[model samples]
Target: MGKQMTEMLKGTLEGIVLAILSVRPAYGYEITARLREQGFADIAEGTVYALLVRIERNGLVGVEKVPSEKGPPRKVYSLNVPGREYLEEFWTTWGFLADRLGQLKEEGK
Candidate 1:
């Protein structure tokens, strides 16, 4: 990703992750992998981990430690009620921005 896209992703990464969890519960690596599958190829695992920590601290996600065959227990995250509510708000805000930005882009052209 270019610097501008990277910067933009930073702003939206939290919502993106929450949106991912809204689909299903997943561990950190799985979340990162899903992001890659969705075209966020440049997102670092460490970035996702850090964001996970933040959201977990904020009580936006409910986590469970499940045994991992490869290493220590994995912390699988699920979107709780609060998380879902936040995700809904995120989508609303995103829609508002998208509409405005779309208008601006057309105006510029």
Candidate 2:
């Protein structure tokens, strides 16, 4: 990943994961794949798992262990009520930041 992209992702990765989960439940591997498919190709698999652990610890999401055909049970994650609320806040914050940045960019032009 480019330095700029990596720096940009630092603060936004959690919200990105939450946004993904908000759409549907997914396991760690699935989440990683989805992120990659969505253009976050540089995100590491372990990073997603670490975020999952943090969110689970913080009561933001719920987990279910489902049997996987290829291996052991997969721990699927879905957004909980708190997670939904958090995601809403994230969007609000993101929008505010984006608007401010756009204004600054326009001013610089």
Worst-scoring 10-residue span by lDDT in model 1:
2-11
lDDT of 2 by residue, 1-109 (tens): 7999988987699999999999999899999998899888889899999999999999999999999989878999999999999999999999999999999999998
Q: lDDT at 24 for candidate 2? A: 91
Candidate 1 per-residue lDDT over residues 24-102, each given as its tens digit: 8999999999999999999999999999999999999999999989988999999999999999999998999999999
- The reply for model 2, stretches above 4 Å from the true place, is none
Pairs that collide in candidate 2 are: none
In angstroms, give how far residue 14 of model 2 lies from its true place.
Answer: 0.6
RMSD of each: 0.9, 0.9
Residue 65 alpha-carbon offset, candidate 2, angstroms: 0.6
Give lDDT for model 1: 0.93
